[model samples]
Target: MKTFFQELKNRRVYRVAITYVIAGSATVQVVGTVLPIFHAPDWVQQVFVALVAFGFPVALVLAWCFDLEDGAIKMTCGDGRAVVTSRRVWILAGVGLLVAGSALTGYWLWHPWKRLSDAASMSSDTLSAPPVIEKSIAVLPFENLSDDKQNAYFADGVQDEILTDLAKVADLKVISRTSVMQYKTSAQRNLREIAKALGVAHILEGTVQRAGGRIRVSAQLIDARTDMHLWAERYDRDLADVFGIESELAQQIVSQLKSKLSAREKAAIEQKPTADLAAHDLYIRAKTLIASSALSTPQAESLLEAVHLLNQAVERDPAFARAYYQLAEAHDLLYLQGIDHTPARLAMADGAIQSLARLRPNSGEAHLAFAKHFYWCYHDYDRAREELTLAQKSLPNDPLPFQLAGYIDRRQGRWPESIKNLERAIELDPQNSAFLEQIARSYECLRRYVDAERALDRAIALVPKDAAMRARRAEIELHWHADARPLMSTIQAIIAKDSREGKNIAELWLYGLLCERDFDGALRALAALPIDGCHQETILFPRVWCGGIVARMRGDTASARAAFTSARNELAKLVREQPAYAEALCALGMADAALGHKEDAIREGRRAAELLPVAKDAIVGPLLVQNLALIYAWTGEKDLALEQLSIAAKLPGYLSYGQLRLHPYWDPLRGDPRFEKVVASLAPK
Candidate 1:
């Protein structure tokens, strides 16, 4: 105002105020946008700039419109009356702008919000070691070196004991049997990739050749990163000294790792198993079949055989607690898979625990198995953790407990922690496809497709015969890129496999349609599903997020919004019922972002993050994390979005890496510095 400016000129504060506002706005916009790059999600940085771009002019326009210049000293209208002049108006405007900026700033910092925008680029890194120590070790899976294949159990028993003994040492980071067994036959991938994939420095490989009373065992340790031989040893001994040989080998390996060891660890290595060699061998065979079965049917056959063998072993050596322990694990595995062998499972678990208690006062495997029995079969979390804790004490080197712990942590919604344990499990068993799948799933929850794909790739290679693995790979490729014809063809091949079995295989068609952006084709595929399961393939909470996916491919946000609304409702139902469906929550968050429901998107994405740790290992995790991260960036939660993307980038493997990177949801984050990092992190190893 001329009057206020005239009066304010005398005070000297008016000029300072305008200059300050201009400078401060510029400073906030410039510094705020870039600063978030270090801490905020990639998308959030873009949002920070956008908010400033939007807010400043509006603020300036208001200042001009209200004519509340000169700190509101006076505002005289043309009528020559002060238009309700109040100095508070100046303060109010400043306060309102600050409040708006602060609110947006908070959004820029939301962790879960950022996860939405970066979900697509999520991935699986580098390593360092303690300088004072040179690590060396070897791991050997129990080889089936029996003529009747009946003695296969004995070989497994030998390996298990050796692994257990090596695990007890504090100085060693022993690669668990699971990781080493990944190299059971052929390893096409380079050692570095294998080592990096396994999270282990050295790999131990061995073979067992046994004939009647005689045994020949040979082992060699190679550094995965350098392809250097750390150690090699062979033991030719009577079957009677089998236990002694394993114990001695473990001790020798521990010494070779070049780490410090405690007296307790040394004692643990020497502790004898309560199993007679013959009985233990039989028990090992049972364990082998029990571990191999995936579904309930095969699992049943294996466990039943285990029970029979264990009974014989028990009869042969009445004091064989190891036999009892395996018997317990078999029943527990079956029950957890919802197999109908509950009664047998329970009886066997109880008997094993009881026998183990008498044989050794503290045994982790028994307790861990007991925990699984209670947790999965009886629906008890506390008891499961408790048992796992005891198992941790007894068999610290065993990855099964940690694997189960990861599962438990997930069920509890501890995403970061669950993922950490799952990662540890992978380190223990690098080639275990199931564990790799789990790691992939964790990244997927954060929406890290890049990382997820690496894990998935490893899994696919491990068991090429696994139709499901191929199908999963197809799904990831479908979502990763809209224009990926090759990926679609891969998915189609996966579906064609099921055609022979008379299964619907509709998800393949639907996903293929979505990738092609042919809504009609998708609808046709959806219609072919068994009524209730149709939505299981598409138009469901997460599957429906592909609607937004489809719309984005078509460059039609309106269609995306409509699909998003439907997805939101579906997500709402999931949140209402279980409230722990992180993938569903994540999908909702992404849909919300596409539709411009920024506030709602952030809120929903946060819930998804909360639920991700506890989410089940499913096909949707990568999409969930990637989409949610994209949302956060769009809404201006830069730091959070970046953090989310970082996590997503490490997902074991993503079904759709390329597509998510190119999606419209991440458009807001494009060209951001942190986004570059996300891209780098997501690039293949």
Candidate 2:
């Protein structure tokens, strides 16, 4: 036994295990993060936990059994005497097994408290939100210093360029543009909340200012964990040196993150874009046109011109992946909007984006283009999500993916969720006129009129001469009060303003206002908008809605019935196909109520409400409650009606706000004191 112990202690494996245990334990303690444990099964986690939990006990047992400090193995018999004592070697061998096992467990349990706490704080839904990311960042809105709002696009271009440059560092995680922009004007979120939402540890924030023939940029890298300002600086240069500014900013971030930059990464930072000043400006301006919420034909055409100049950019420098990516983006935008010949444009754009992607595998734009190509044209939601993830990594500050996420949610009737994503997109590009428009639209859809008004006010201020913003504001106000006068006057001003400038967005504005209530402005818009040659069976629904709204206004039930009959079957089919089609269900319910189909109204209203649980101020949420109340009233179930009305009265600016305004549908219970008491309770204090 003494000889066996001596040999075991002398073995090289004994020394190796001790070294590994010490080094591995220190690594586990110092470098541990959630990264190592993700996507691992519960049983694996338990095995790791068991290893860590048993480390100290095992070490003690090994020490007792080996007598390692004494350089011998002591074996005790049943009589409690040391029956056999071995030499140094065997004792050290047992110590080695104990230490190795202890280190493995320690590594598993590193930062256990923090890991568990972090996991506990997140909701699964938010964790699983679309455009998943490993790293996240927030791009605050660019500051506007230029006198002309038109120059706003230059700031956006600068920001986009920097995002593109940073994407070259493939190992670093990046948040997509859409999520960070939502915080531009947010009064609620802190840095931690922002980081958690974007799922990133670091953040890159910056500001841009435009001056005559020159630009100034200020940028910072933030350590999200500490909420510390890790680095910050300002750059003032001639407009021609914009590329320099972008590269410098990226290099600065890499330095701050202490990232190891490869030769390819270093080369990517210094690549030059177009030297033609006119072409760059044109491209920036073109991006502005497409950025607007309402798709404008003239803007699209202008963007095409910009794309032509961007071609000139690549002509000057064949190595410009950024230019190529933008060109691909422009073509896809045209194709999606039904402007450019889709097949040719899509094929060319896809090929260009793919080429650019190969050159810069970390490019957000490249991944974004491919994701969009599959998402819009191919309807491959899963592939789209994967591409969006990679795109987010490449360019973490652009809002397009967030905007896409929001748009998808809205179409699915997840209005609250959609609004959250859209708002983030606006934060990324606060000065962007397009972002403002989408936010306002989202607010309006969710029936948050105050929020819509605030967004619209900002947009109109940015583009005071533009008629669309003003029209949208007026339309929102009209719905809030259920009155059309304010909307009518705003459109006249819009038409007058457009006539002087030849910008025809006022007609588009009118088309939208007509759709809002269908009753208020459709006839005037129908008289003005283009409808001469196009023939699609889908056209009948808008026409029917227009008729319904008109009849509803005048209390002409029969006319409303006839008009609705033309669209009812189609609408019913639509609701069946997409259960989350809140708009269709809400409209159908309202039409049914007006036509005295109580059962149909109740059913559709209930379905819409369920589908839109998180949507605040939604007409459907309140409308469902209101209709349920009315149904109870008509059926002599006044108690039930009162209950539904009570539920409705809880909504912002709707329930108690309109309690006194009597509508005939609730007349059956008007004489009852119970109804009056319910109404009184609902009215705002």
Candidate 3:
């Protein structure tokens, strides 16, 4: 072993090995970075590294067989025929180099190809023998083939009906409508690509054509892996027979996909929602229009039009349960949109829901609508939970029920349960931005700010043009983290590109300025806002509140009093109209507190807390209680304030260390040890 080592040293093999390694590493590094820029295939870089590695052994063998002499490579002489051996060594070295180069080049080229072939075989094996999933399917939007493009709603209605029926089957994994409709207006991609994106094994594609009193639907089921049509059918039916067509299509698809259906599911599929074709048509049109309206920016005109259409639908067929449910949805949305957040509109929604319940005693749609009404209007969390449970039972496959359940859990401070329910909804409706945002809200309540930001980022990616999402992201950074500089550029860009989103951007700027205690900047932001009468209650309310705070900060008592009085009066009117409105009462309390009306502030704040007690309203409960605590702190009721703060800190709500540190309302509490402990409790883990 020692002689072998000495021979290696004598031949300078170590030097050759080190040199080869250094050169090989440099070559690999260079190729790895440069080849990618030229859009070279990954295999090209792999082959280069493999070739360099191959040269290492060849170089070492050459070092052992030859010696560097007089700046030239010469074969070693150990025998009598030194000249002959040197000549033969040169020839053999040349042959060895040629063979090794060829061999390495061949291996580099062939080895990856072989491994890739094996990988492909394995992939194919896994795909062919996929883990058992319950008959997963994605039903692409049916093509509208009518002369009048307005008939697109009719096509969507038919497709939705079929999907609705299929979703009732417990043994099937049906992707929700939101994800499936994304392919409707967009350019179609490969069927397999669509299927893979939806996490389904089968694809349902079809076209719909409607004439005066007749409807034509052509549907085919395909194996997503091979894009092979499993079944094809064409139905030419009377307009009134459309429900039957949907039922039959659903049955055929189930059979083709080999999914089992219980007796109840079969019964549900066979039942017709409405026998009157006119009522059905009107309901579908209203539903299509209502679906297009924005929930956050509800237009009164659009909602009124849908209401008119839905009213006509129910009048045409008084017993049409689906029409009644859609009518309720339109009414509820009209009120929810806050375009018509009046008692009359809320009463109308209640009336519609009652009618729906009377018409369809066990309808999932009725239960879901009632759940919304109970949650948003009545604020009856327990009743809302019961309704949601019934809805889930009736619509086991519907994402709406699960989503609503998640929201109920969120508002009730069940953070983990809320997350689980929202995640379930995401599994059903994978591309829903609203679901993603709600999930972020749940994360926020849990103080999982990082996870919340990630969720918001995902929601923003899905809806890049959504001003609400951008505002939400800004709020998290500015108000929750007290870090708004990073998001300032984005806010400015959004405002510059679309002045219409200026109001939302300005609100973000105001929050950012407030976080920094920049009173002048806050006043400037308030000035730049476009406050119109239509949005005075929403847009102007914040401006007034901020203006009051900034004026007080600058020692302008008269201006502060005027601002606070203006905000208080407006909020007082809202509270008078809706006595149970916790948010309006809280705002009034905040205004009173700002004006130094200690007694009034305490009264209004306590009233707000009573209306939104933590036992019944987890979402607004903690916020209102915290507002009361702020007032108490400012009025020097240290014990009362600390008690509220401790309770608020324990709840899964929006209280945070940043808010405690930055909010001017809580400035008086900063010196208190109890306040510091409460804020410290929320420290990031």
Candidate 4:
């Protein structure tokens, strides 16, 4: 054994092995760092590792069989001799130093956890030890410090751009714009408390000022746990370099937090949305309006304003993909509001979507915009799902994409997946009422009333002043919980707080009265709302339908006939003005049925059903189908009513099983075995 070792040393095989390892490890370290910068595939690193391993044995064999004489390789004989010299030992020592350097480089390149402080790296053995969190952050709404308060939109735009840039970093958990906007003018919560509430390690607060053609931005990063200022900076730049300011701010945040950014993320952070500053400003302003108007008391008018603003933005810079995306979103809101369903509106929305696709082919916002158009406008569930999947890949950090995906899943009867996606969205925007509301609705669909109620309570807490939100919560209580007491008390309290805003809760008041079988109270609530004040088709249709139903329940046949005639006249005019208005046609059909015009009801209902077959998954389609079934039931067509009920039970539209069981419209078919089966199927397993 001693002779074999001597021979190996004499042949320089041991030196060769050490040298090869030192060179190979150094090469691996370099490759690891450089490959990621170039956005190289993961397999490239694997292949490099494999090649290094394969070369190790080849290097040793070459060292044993060949000798370098004047840099020329010549055959050499290995003999048992003490040929180890000090030169070779010193060379080995140098190789040892090289190995250590390579090891240090490899540690720096591959092991990120090593960079964390000992306190942050402590084991979680102690019960009282604080748990280590990832590089998570929340960028609070930037204060508008401009001389002109109207420049508030500009400040918001600046903050949003920074937050968006930071979100591109996968290593950082960025709280979304929706959740952060709650802090826009709020001063009640301390930094530490706000960070804890948002589940972030750091909080970013900033101020923006825009004057004439120049801009100034000041930002600071604070340690949420200790309330320590980690970093702060100020920037003065021309309006044209606004994108640079955002990119620099994002880079500074990443640097302060020691967050790693992938090549794609870096590119995304630096990519400017538009070259036209005016157009970009318009887009940002539109986004701000859209965000504020989402599910607000007067969302329709606000969305229309945003739509007009986005149109100007797109015309200014036809290549503005984000503007086009926002335009599509505005159209989607208009569609969902049932304010307009004209082909011209649909075509304009489609044009916006096409612009998004052309301008930003790989953008998540583009995919999300197209997905919304498909899901809401076209009711193409499969195509919407596919686009959403692509959107998820493109904008993995965005909660909106996941939220939309959840809605699509719910519409397609994929309850578990829907809940999962909605929950994920909540994780990203914990305080967002829109996401919370959708989650509650999804839970209601599964008949998980308790969970649904809990979600609604959270949403109501987030937006207590929102009458529409209050109405929805009251609805959940009335139908799902089969309890009118809570709904009555809640609606009364909301009304007592502010009578003007209380009008918005009239629908819920009517629902509560109906739940208690109090027709007179429902009529009173309907009178308070008054058709003249209710412009939303959703609210208007419901008011007219419930008013007629309440009058019928009270045995006031004349009042019931008058209400039905009014609703029929209004809906008929709407259908004539916009023949594409499927919901209006359905409303007209239901009104006709209520007035005992069975043939007219059938004709109108069939026309609605045939006008938009794709809308069966939308609110209008199932609503039309349900009303058509109501028409069939009123005319003594039990089989058709049960058939429509079964179809509606599976759709996202119409009432809950509890509502179906108690609704007066379905009472005509209540004793039928098929109706019972359909209602029974709605019960959660």
Task: For candidate 3, write residues 231-330 as lDDT tens digits.
Answer: 9999998877888999999999988888888887899899998877777778878876776664323245566788899889888888888877777777
Please provide TM-scores, in order, for all candidate models, with all chains considered together.
0.56, 0.45, 0.73, 0.73
TM-score, cand. 2 vs. native: 0.45
Off by over 4 Å in 2: 1-246, 249-268, 271-297, 412-416, 447-451, 477-482, 496-498, 501-503, 508-685
Ten contiguous residues minimizing lDDT sum, candidate 1 = 124-133
- Local accuracy by lDDT, each model: 0.62, 0.59, 0.75, 0.75
Give each model's clash number. Answer: 72, 24, 0, 0
The residue-by-residue lDDT of candidate 1 on 135-221, one tens digit each, is 634464645656767665566667778877877765566667655665545535466666665556776666677887888887777
In model 3, how large is the Cα lDDT of residue 120?
A: 42
Candidate 4 structure quality by residue, lDDT tens digits, 438-517:
77766565556666666777788878778778777767755664567777887778777877765667666776677677
The lDDT, on a scale of 0 to 1, for candidate 4 is 0.75
Runs in model 1 lying further than 4 Å from the true structure: 1-113, 116-157, 187-196, 222-231, 260-264, 271-278, 295-298, 341-345, 439-458, 461-465, 473-491, 495-685
